[model samples]
Target: MRIIIGSKNPTKWKAVQDVFDTYQVDTLNAPSRVSSQPFSDEETREGAINRALQCAESTPGAIGIGLEGGVMYIKDQLYLCNWGALVTEDENIYTASGARIVLPIDIAEQLKAGSELGDIMDQYTRKEEVRENEGAIGIFTNDSISRRNMFVHVVKLLRGQWEYWINK
Candidate 1:
């Protein structure tokens, strides 16, 4: 099977490829031509589906996959990460959980003010590109925590729980 991934993030691509690597299938990157920015839950899913479908359609008989990660507000708190979707041309779905992080109050307030978390922190701290390296945690302390690691764990569901239609 030819599988296309809809993301330029090496982390996401690696995570997805790792799952299918054991199988006798080929993989390629074809990140969604659509916007990557998160808007709403429904829109985000559509973005993923569209990308996956686009890839699937492009190769005639290939399987397309899409992964999306974004921040969400939960109970007045900022939830930093969550998985999006996995789609096939056959219209199958293999959704998974996303990484989760609790935003500190200061960060939450800044997100509430319609500012991208990293960009907002970049302005207040004036550390010159700290957000890209440190992000939310950069505001307080240096930590090894990263969304990329979190996503790897979440994407591991295909190991046991997922029933692969392509394999079937």
Candidate 2:
């Protein structure tokens, strides 16, 4: 089976590769058609769905996968959130969300002021391209859950759902 990842980011590619190692995986420049930094779980999940649908539309015979990271407010506090989606060849869509962590007030304020989490994280840690590597999740979780690791979990969820549908 051929898998088409709806992103060109290496971290996302690695996450899909980790879960679908036996399959032929390829990346595409699929657009999420959402905010650069999604602000809510609903919006983030929509972005993932958009990307997955776009990938599937562009590559008819392959399964399309999308991964998205964003922040959301839970009980008046901002938290980091991740979401992912998978589109089967038959056009069945599956979605799953990953772990979330509360963000510090300062970061929340910056995000509220229109700063992307990746940029804020880069400045906060003086590290370049944190999103491409460890990501905000890694920094906040102290590497217990790297960004790729979180996405891997979400992708695995999508895979499990897809497998169940196929087998059943």
Candidate 3:
């Protein structure tokens, strides 16, 4: 199962590698750089889809992945997280479920103000170093886990039983 990821982000790509790297596959990158933009009208979903499509179209590999997050209202509170997508060489689509956690007050404001959540945190956060330590999975800030661990976890959830997915 040779896979090609659309992103060059070490943290995010490492997550994909952790799960699929062990398989009988060769993962490659797309010819062009992939975007972190949202795919749908909603930021998160839109970002995920855009990444996946752009990645697949641009890359020369069997699989391309895009993951992103946007705020969705659950009750009165809003949460943000990963909205993921998987695409195969034959254009088969597989999706990952999004799991969101609530945003801290100050952080939420910046995101609502149209700044990318990651960028805002990279500039301002409780611990200035947290921006460097954490990646999309959001482990370093609150959890004892490292960015590596979060990537592995993401890979697990996104890895599919590709053995049976014969490209028609």
Candidate 4:
């Protein structure tokens, strides 16, 4: 089976590859059609869905995958949120989201000021393309978990649903 990931970000691509190790994995730069820093779960999930559908349409007879990371405000606290989607050639779509982590006040403020979380994390950590590497989650967690691993977990969830659906 072939899987086409909906982003050029290596981390996301790697996550999908890791989850679906037996498949032929490829990536394309698909548009999310949402803010760089989505402020709500609905917006974030929509972006993932859009990317997945677009990528699936981009390639025939393949599974398209999308992963989107954003921030969400809940109970007056800013939390990091990540969502993932999988769309099959048959147009069956499956989605899963990662665990949310509350952000530091400083980071939250920068995000509220119209800065993307990846860029802000890069600036704060003096790193480049953190999103393509360990990512904000890794930096915050002291590398206990990486951005790739986070998406891998989300992809696993989607895979579980896909397996169940196929079996039924």
**Number of the predicted model whose lDDT against the real structure is largest:** 2
TM-scores, all models, native as reference: 0.66, 0.98, 0.71, 0.98
Candidate 2: clashing pairs of residues: none
lDDT of candidates 1 onward, in order: 0.58, 0.94, 0.56, 0.92
In model 4, the Cα lDDT at residue 40 comes to 94
Please write out the lDDT profile of model 1 over residues 1-168, one tens digit for every residue. 666776665655666666777644334455545444453445555666666666666676666666665566677777665454555666666666554667678767766667775576678677655433544543443456544454456566533344555557
- The reply for model 4, stretches above 4 Å from the true place, is none
141 in model 3: Cα distance from truth in Å? 5.7
lDDT of 1: 0.58
lDDT sort, best first: 2, 4, 1, 3
lDDT of 2 by residue, 74-121 (tens): 898999999999997778999999999999999999999999999999
Range of the 10 consecutive residues with the lowest summed lDDT in candidate 3:
32-41
Clashing residue pairs in candidate 1 are 6-31, 7-31, 82-98, 83-98
Better of 1 and 2 by TM-score: 2
